[model samples]
Target: MASERILSKVAEEQKKHALNVAMATTAAAEAAVAAAQAAAEVVRLTGAAESCQRFRKFDPNLAAIRIQSAYRGHLVSPS
Candidate 1:
């Protein structure tokens, strides 16, 4: 029957549409995951850079103090 054939055709089209929608959803999920990973990497690297900067700022002061202490030790020691 023609009605049966039409119903079959409609069912096939619906199936294809559903598959397309599912594929699109999967792609969107993958893109979101990748973006989240990238953001996390940026945060980690920024934290590391800030920590290095803090240590760099401390290192020069520490070196100067060590140098001054060494000079004082030399002055106190006998010739």
Candidate 2:
């Protein structure tokens, strides 16, 4: 009867350990997915910024002229 009780206690401990491991695995997976999503967003924003730089370089004088014209019309910088 003592051996049976010891076995039962070990089984309970094993179940608790298994549950803890499963929760940790799930949390790690969620973190990995979030990191991937953030990386993708960074890539997308980087591409957009690069595209704008290209446009600015394509016609520097034209962009400056447009900015001046807009400013004259009372369009202030949002910054």
Candidate 3:
């Protein structure tokens, strides 16, 4: 039956189209995940850099204050 043959062909084409659509969707999802991971990595690196900068700025000031406090304590505490 010619009609049956045509129907089978149409079904095969439909299956191929469906598979193509699924592959495209999977590719898009993978790309989105990769982009998000890259962005997260950038944010993590930036935060680390900022924390290091803050510690570098704070350490010397903290040391100076501690020295000053020790000197004052030595003068004020009666032995």
Candidate 4:
């Protein structure tokens, strides 16, 4: 009868350990998912910034050409 009592106590401790392990695993998985989501957001924001920078690039030659074209047009037209 004492052995039966000891066996029951061992089984109870095993159940508690299993529950703790399951909880730890769940927390780790949630942290991993959050990290992945944060990484994806960084990638999205970086892509947007790069695209905007591309459009904002300057071209001095284009500016000069546009100014010259306007000046020629003005010189040839009646004042």
lDDT of 1 by residue, 1-79 (tens): 9999999999999999999999999999976865665556556655655566766565645434544555555456664
lDDT of 4: 0.66
TM-score: model 1 vs. ground truth: 0.64
| Model 2 lDDT per residue over 1-79, tens place | 9999999999999999999999999999976865665556556655655568866567656544544454444334332
Residue clash pairs of candidate 1: none
Question: Over the stretch 1-79, how does candidate 3's per-residue lDDT look in tens digits?
Answer: 9999999999999999999999999999976865665556556655655566766475645434544555455456663
Considering summed lDDT, which 10 consecutive residues are worst modelled in model 4? 59-68
TM-score of 2: 0.65
For candidate 3, the clash count comes to 0
Model 2 global lDDT (CA atoms, 0 to 1): 0.67
Estimate the lDDT of model 3.
0.68
Give the per-residue lDDT digits (tens) of candidate 4, residues 28-58. Answer: 9976865665556556655654566554367
For candidate 3, the per-residue lDDT at 59 reads 66
TM, every model: 0.64, 0.65, 0.62, 0.63
lDDT of 3 at 73: 56
